[model samples]
Structures are given as structure tokens and as C-alpha cells.
Target: MKPRTLVIGDIHGGLKALKQVLARAEVTAQDTLIFLGDYVDGWGESAQVIQFLIELEQKQTCIFIKGNHDLWCEDWLKEHILDKTWLFHGGQSTLKSYESLNDAEHALHLNFFERMRLYYVDEQNRLFVHAGFTSMHGPAQEFHQSNFKWDRTLWEMALTMHKHITKDSKLYPKRLLLFKEIFIGHTPTLNYDVTIPMNGCNVWNVDTGAAFTGSLTIMDIDTKEFWQSDTLVSLYPNEKGRNR
Candidate 1:
């Protein structure tokens, strides 16, 4: 089989959904998996998700990009301090998930989080980031690193200019011109009433809202082919899963 480069969206601790999507995608060790982060904080298996990914990395080529939720989890792992805002947004579930992990396992997961990249630009000039960057020059030139994990302006601009403006037009966004394509996952497509990956201009958003009531997605970057799991609410029926 030919090697493939697959981009995955946010897991939000839905380990079952993540597993289902990977199986549906028929992912192989020969493929390179680029995960868009948010591995924790939503469902009840954040720790399990991290552990699974850690094991998955041993056999498959994987690129992990850090997301905003992952950053908050990392901070708590390192400092033992919980942010009220984080708790309100789903950190409580993550905290409960970690209760089953030993100190050694926690240390391993922390190391995994610390090693994640803010953004990655491929040799083909395709950018894979957990979220969007603000720099017109590219993510490397970004002034505020946090934007790499939290900015929505880039995606918004792409949507607004999608088919309205041509690349040659003076009104075209300089930031959009920097990459051949961009893949991201901070924002969910369900917000716009979509369950599949959403495309705007050269940007593709793969987050289909697995944290709440949607599914987890994995896409083949070259073919734009994608696979998704069943709705998270159905997978974990008893849990609210960040729906609150």
C-alpha cells in the first residue's frame, strides 16, 4: 500500500471515537498521522487517550500539534494547580481521568505534552497547526505563540475570502498566501452546522466537534478523503462530554 499523510482533528478525550475513526480510516504504520491536539479534557478518558497515543507512537509515524486545552492540562500536570476557567470548560473530567494514573505515568504524559509542536510546515508548504497563527509571514514569524493554539482570525479570514477573492487580487490575505494549504482543528465545524471537515480557501478545518455531540475525524491530506466515528454522545451515553 502507498504511504499516506493523514490529519486528525481534536479528540477531546473521546478515546473510543478516536479508535473508531482510526479503524474506519484503515490507518497503517506506514502512514504518517498528524494529530491536531486537544487530546484531553472533554470525555472521561483523557489519561487513557494520552496513554494510547503514547503507545501508538511507538509503532506509527505521528506528529502531534499542541492545542489550547492540552496547554491547560500540561500546566496542571506540571504545577498541580487547577484553573477555574479550565474546570468550567471540561478540565474537571480530565482531572477525574488522571486519578487512575500513577505518578510515573503522569510524568510520561507530561513529557509527551511538552514535546508537542505549536505548528508544522511540510516540505510541500502545507501547514498543520492545532489552531491558527496570526503572522502574515507564517507561523515561524508569529509574535504571540499563544495564537498558534487559540486564534480564529485566520480561519475566519479564509471563510470570508473563500470564493469571494482570488489569490491574485489585492484584497487577498497575505497570511493565506504563505502556505500552499493549511490544516487546523481548534474550532469545530458543528458550530456552522457541519459534521464533516470544512474547507475555506486553502484552509481545511477537521474538527467536527467530538468534544460535544459530534464525531472524531481523520482525513487524508492529499486526497481530502476523511473518515469519522459515530456521534460522541452515543459512544459515551452517560457522560455530558463538555455539552454543558
Candidate 2:
């Protein structure tokens, strides 16, 4: 049997939830795991989460995409400057997680973050992006850095586009037809009023809002089968989440 390509949504430092989602998904050595980023911030345990991922890489294939939060983290690690925006959006918890690490350990974590990708395209033309592509030229065109980690217009377009239009209703946008499937995570599924993964046009949103009150999601790229953890609030019963 072929190993499944499992694409996971934003983790947001929810280590317990991340563990449960992986366990429920029955992840194994043969499976390929693609993390959608925002690995730090929100809940506590950001350091431990990165450590766990580093260890997991020794056993299975894993791909880490860079999200907006992850980019902030990289900036902090590389420049040694605190970003006010990152701080306002759960950066404190991430900083707390790294406070105890020694120089070597800190370097290891930084290296991992530095190696993350902006976007990944598979052989079949499927695109996996942290947020979404922003090229007016479409998916085949290289995207700007902001588009890969911070673009919300793609999701907005996907959500609001008309399913059917008159023949003369202006040229249908080419963005929706650029890829066989585009998987993303920055936009939480709950925003769409659904807790589970929601498919719009050819885009699939897997971020079930692990940073807030939502659950963590893990889905099979081909099968579309998914498993999710309990509500994030339940994962850290004793503490309030970052944005909660």
C-alpha cells in the first residue's frame, strides 16, 4: 500500500492536540506529513512542539511550510528584535517557550525554521501553501513572499465566487483553474461556519483554528479523509488560549 500524504493544519503550539490528531490519523513511518505552519504561538509549549517535529523528521517524511507567524519567529531569531505585531498575536507564549533553551538548542530550532518553504508543488500540480498564492498570473507564476504567507484574498475569492455565471459575465477568474487542488491553512474553517475542513471551488482549507477554540485537523491529500482533535480549549484546560 502507498503511504498517505497527510496535510496538517496550523498547530499554534497545541502540542497535545497535535499529538492526538497524529495518533488518530494513525501516522506511520511510511506516511508523508506536511505541516501548514503557524507552528508557534497561541497555546503554550511552542518549544516542545518544535522539538517534537525535529524528532519526528528522523522517522518519517515531513514538509514544513512557512506561515505568517513562523515568518515573525524567523525574524526574531535572525534579527534578535521583538516584533510588536507578533507580540500582540501570541508571540509572548512562543518567547516564553524558548527562554530556557541553551545556545545550541536555540540554534537548532532556528535552523529548522530557516529551512521552511513558502509553498510546495507536487508532481501532480497540486499546490500546498501556508496561505495562498497571490500572483495575478496564477499558480504557475512565482508568487510574492507576502502572497505565500499573508494573502487572504484568495480565500475570500474562493468563498464568494459565484458557482455559475452567464457566458458574457466577464472572463471567469483564472486563479481557480491554476491547480488541480490547492490546500491552505491560514484561514480557519470555523470562519466558514463549519468546524471540519471545507472545500470551496478547488481549494481546501484545513486550518480548523487550533489557535483559538477550534480543533486541530489532519487530512489525507488523496482520500480527503481527515481526523481532528477535541476543541483546543479542552487541550489546555487550565489556561486561556492566546486569542480566546
* Top candidate (TM-score): 1
lDDT of 2 by residue, 107-195 (tens): 89899999999888888888899898777676547546788888888888877764654223466557766778889999988776789
Clashes of 2: 0
lDDT of each: 0.94, 0.87
Pairs with backbone N, CA or C atoms under 3 Å apart (clashes), candidate 1: none
Point out where model 2 deviates above 4 Å: 139-143, 165-170
* lDDT computed for candidate 2: 0.87
**Which tens-of-lDDT digit does each residue in 36-99 have in candidate 1?**
9899999999999999999999998999999999999999999987999899889999999999
Which window of 10 residues has the lowest lDDT sum in candidate 1? Answer: 133-142
Model 2 RMSD to the real structure?
2.1
Point out the worst 10-residue segment of candidate 2 by lDDT: 164-173
